[model samples]
Each structure stands twice: as structure tokens, then as C-alpha cells.
Target: MTTLFDRFERAFMPNYGVPPVALARGEGTRVWDVDGAEYLDFIGGIAVTSLGHAHPALVEAVSTQVATLAHTSNLFLHEPEVKLAERLLALLEQPGKVFLANSGTEANEAALKLAIKYGKTTGRSYFVAAEMGFHGRTLGSLSLTGKPSIRDQFGPFATDVRFVPYGDADALAKAVDENCAAVFLEPTQGEAGVVPPPDGYFAAAREIATRTGALLVADEIQSAIGRTGHWFAHQADGVVPDLLTLAKGLGGGLPIGAVVGFGAAGTIFAKGDHGSTFGGNPISCAAALAVLDNVDLEHVRAVAERLRTGLEGIAHPLLNGVRGRGLWLAAVLTEDRAAQVQTAAQQAGFLVNAVQPDAIRLAPPLVVTPAEIDTFLAAFPAILTEAHHG
Candidate 1:
């Protein structure tokens, strides 16, 4: 019999493959499948649902804004967009400008252009980015991504970018030169199994960028908007980036991205330099503001700490260690059976990501509770056991 999965495979592009389960509903930090089975949603739509599923504040803001003014594009001005920019600047505590977009890739594209234009003024053409960092999937942003497997076929990419090893201060210093336009980094490497860089690495990068006169761009697409218990992940280290890109949890599951630039990078873009039709739509702006105002970040940060402790307390044999900060973390396995572990986790009524062969990344909503963490911790030992045995 031809099933729903078969139909999806036939009709859709196979980039993500056919997901095993189709969720019908979600509330708080939980979701239900078409068969009515419930799951503790630990993935949170790849860290997009910061306020959890179907958050009332987000729902109301989106609903009201859609009912009022939906989209004005970049040809017109809107209050919600202005308000969001102001709010973000308030959080950043810097003189800056915000360019809103539809997703993380779009934000990165805009940032790339801003850097290139700023470079034109400075007489620089080269760019430096960290290896193992994920910017996005669109061709422009994809070119900046350091993964060879994904970046291989999409060749003829602009040769302006040079890659350095993540968290390696000496390598970054060597790579970033006077001719470099910008240096891109991720506060925490999310797709590379939620890896955390060494302490003071960002500070070192900031100093290097300053020395080279290059714009320091921080891709906080996966770690911004309180995902790491700070408004921006770089804030934890007290470093202000020249260009900060954000998406993921910014709109609390609604699609929206932003490129926030500071100092000279802030004023580099003039009219018509970049624009997106659906970017900064009133509804998305409203939803983002609601997420910023209503999320219980204090509780979220506390639960994140507890999760770090609770996961390590399991002390499973196949488990090597856990890395990352706040709600974004990866349980590093001793073997390359992370795919099996992910499947086992799904079978066991949990949702986690095998971001790498030996790493399982966990990026639950910021609204996740202590009880929810307990549930995942309870199931993890057995899940690891199944993967190790299989």
C-alpha cells in the first residue's frame, strides 16, 4: 500500500528524507503524533521554538499583527519592524542597524554583502571564516559554510573566504590579514555537535579582527535570542561583534532573521543594497517581540544548568561526555553509532538529533522544564545502551 511517507517521497525533494512521524499537535514542551502518541520534544524544531510549541503570547501577537498589517516589504516602513530593531539594539547595548530577513541564510547573505561593501571602502577583498561552522543552506551563505560534504557540488563559489580551525586562536591570527574584509564565527558550533570553543577564543578573535581592520561577524543563528541564556552568545564573553546574525529562536518558531551591525559595519548599507519581500513582515516582527518579552529566561537558564548536571550524572559507558552551553548541547558518544541512537530515541518516544556520527545534539525550547529534562535523562541511558548493542 502507498503510505503518506511514500507520497511525500514522491512529491517532495529528498533533502531531509521522509521523517518517520507526522506530528498533529503541540503544547508547551510536548507534541503528539498522528497516531496520538505523545513525545517530549527535545529538538524544538532545530532550536526555533524558544517559547515552546503554540505559545499563547506568540500566537496572539502573530494573530493580531496578521489581522492588522501583514507585510510591507522593504519598499515601505512599518512600526513593528522599527520596534523590533529598537528592541534588539537595546539588548545589544550598541549603536547598530538591523536588517531583517526571512531566515538565517538570508541574514548571512545580507551580512556577507555588508562586509563586502565595507571592504570596498577599506580596499580589502578577502574574508575569513571558521571551519566546522554552519551558516545556512542558500548558495551565498552555503559558500561560507565550512562543511565539505555539503559545500562540494555547489562549486564556483566566490573565492573571497578563507577558513581557519574553530577555537584555535593561533590559526585565526595567522589567517586573518589586512586584506581580509571580515572574519565569521559561531559562538557555539551547533551542527558540529554543539561544540563549545575554548574560553577567551571570541575575545582573541575580536582582537585579531581589530588588528586586521576586518569586521568580526558572529553567526549566532543557533545560539542567539536567549538560547545560551544570554541575549547574544558573544555577550557571555563580553565581546561585541561587528556583525551579528541571528535566526532560529528569534521569532519563537516564526520564520525571521536579522543582521545586526555595529560601528562602521552598521552604517555601510544604504537604500536598495539588500531587501527581502517577506522579511520583517509585521506578523513575524510581532511574534519576535512577544518571544523576547514573555519568555521565562530565568527558568530556562536554570533548567539548562540542571540538564548539564543530570546528563553527566548518568555516566553511561558508551557516553564519552557532554559539551555546549545552556539548552544547546551534544552528548558525545564513545562510538560512531549516533544515527542508531537517534532512531532508538525516536522509537523510545523522544526526539533528538544525530548532528554527527559520534554526537547527538540536543536543542530543546527555552521553555523546557526541569521535569522534561528528567524524562530525557531517564530514557537516555537505555537509548545509548540500545545504540551501543545494535
Candidate 2:
């Protein structure tokens, strides 16, 4: 028999490599393989599935909007898009303008353009970003990303960018100057094993950016949309940013991204500066609205506490400690065994991400049940033991 995975290898690009499992369907925090094996989905499509698989609210919103009006390009106005923009701004408790796109990379690309144009106005050309911080893969966003491993092959990048050590206020202060246009930082470094910045880092960034006349751009793609128990993770530090980029869980499962410009930054873009044809598709906007209305922050906080406490209680030699907040967490290992642990977990009917060689990331749905948490916790120790012994 020609399995789906076999067919996929022949037809698809090799960039993602070949996935071991082919998922056929999902509901809540559970998913089924093409062969009908069930597994608890803790990665949640790399933190994009907010309400879980096939939730009634998400399905209803997507289905209803698609049946009525799927897309209108950017040529026509739609109710869902307008309402979604307003809702996001309201959540921030700030007056801002929103530019919609289709993914996190696009959102960061848009922010990059805005920063460049703003730089022209102030006669500043250089940009500052944190080391190990990931913005996106697009050329514009890629230039701001500090990881050399990913950026090395794609050379001749924008040379005006400066890279500073993440979570170091003195380094950031030294890098940003009156000639700098913007400073990009992530409240939590998602790709770098769910690493969070040191305490008071964001506050210091804000003060430095203000003093140096640089725009503070918060890339909250992975940490926003209630993943960190807040609408935006930087809000926990009580600092307001000039620009914010968001995606991942924003559309609950649909593809959507947004760049929000606050205060004067909101008025930076003039008529016809930038646009996206499928940026604010009606279906995606409706689905995002559903996510916003249905997500219970109080519930998210409680489950996060339960999961964190359970993970910390595990007495295993391989385990070091857990980092990150809310539903976004990484189980740090004492050695480079995350890949083995991920395979062991999958074989034990659980899905996890080997975000780094020594860190396994666990980002479940916002609506993950206590029962699901208990099941994963109970099975985790055995899975770790198997990986350790192997």
C-alpha cells in the first residue's frame, strides 16, 4: 500500500523534511493519525491552535464566514476585519492603527517597513535587535533576526543592523544611539527554547529606546494571544511599545497576522504605502474574533499553574527545570537529549517539540482540560525514563 507519508515525500518540498506521522483529524487536545492511532497534542500546531482542534466556536466562525464571504482582497471593506482590528486595539487599551497580513513573518515584514520609513523621518538608519531573537524568515524580517546559523547562508543582508546580547540592559543601551531607528525584542524567545528575558529587561528597553529616540518593536508572535496568560506578554512589565507584531494563535487556526502602531507610530503609514491581497480574509478575521471571545484568561492562568507545578514536582535525573510562563513552557534537560525525549513522548501517545537539543517545548491549547494535563503528567515520567535508558 502506498501510505500518505510516502506520497507526501514525492510531492512536497524538502525544507520541512519528512514528518513521521500523518494526522487525519483532531478534536480539542486530541488528534488521530492516518492509521487511526490517537495522541494527546501538546504542541498544538506549534502554538497556533488556540481553541484546540475542531472546536465548535472556531468551526462555526470559519464555516459561517466562508459560506458567506471568504475574501474581498484589500480593495473592499469588510465588517469582520474592521471589528477584529478594533478588538485587538481595545485589548491593548491603547489607540492604534492595524495593518493585517497572513502570517507572523508578514507582520514582522510590515513592522520592518514602518521602522525604515520612520527612520528616514528622523535621519536615523541603523536598527538594533537582540541576540538569539527570532523575528521571521522573510528578507526584511530575517535581517533583524540575530541567529547567525539561519542568516549565514542568506548573505548581503541589511548591514545597518546591530546585534546585542539578549536580556543585557547595558549591552542594549550601548548599542542603541540617537542614530538608531528601532530596537526589536521578544518578551520570550520562542525559537531559542522558550527563553524568557531577565526581570526588568523590558522596562529598561523602553527607557533606553525613549532616550535614544528609537522605536521599540515588540515581536509577540509566540507569546501573545493569551499564550503567556496576557493579551500581550510585554504588558506584564507595564511598558507600552511603539510597534507590536502578532500572529500564531491570533486566528485560532486560520492564517492571519497583524502589525499594530501605537500613538504617533499609528500615523506613520500614508496612503498606499503597503497592503496585502489576502491579509484580512473574512474567514480568518471571523475565526480570530471567535478566539478572542472564547478564550478565558482566568482559566488559562489556572491550568498553567497546574501544569507548571506538576512539571516541577517530577523527580527525574534528566530534568533540570522548567522555564517560560502560562501555557508556553520548555522542559529543560541537563544534557542534549531533547530529540530522544520527543520521540519517546510521541511513541507514548503524546506530541511535544524538541525546540532545542536540551529543551522540549510544551505549548498546549488554551482550552486544554485538567484531565488532559493529568494524563500527560502521569505518562511523562515513564517517557523520560525510556529516553534516558535508550
Q: How many residue pairs collide in each prediction?
A: 0, 0
**Candidate 2 per-residue lDDT over residues 170-234, each given as its tens digit:** 99999999999999999999998999999999999999999999999999999999999998899
What's model 2's lDDT at 194? 95
C-alpha lDDT values of all predictions: 0.91, 0.94
User: Lowest-lDDT window of 10 residues in candidate 1?
Assistant: 152-161
Measured on C-alpha atoms, candidate 2 has an lDDT of 0.94
User: What's the CA error at residue 263 for candidate 2, in Å?
Assistant: 0.4
Task: Name the regions of candidate 1 deviating beyond 4 angstroms.
Answer: none
Q: Put down candidate 1 lDDT per residue, 59-81, tens digits, no spaces.
A: 89999999999888778989999
**Per-residue error (Å), model 1, residue 53:** 0.6
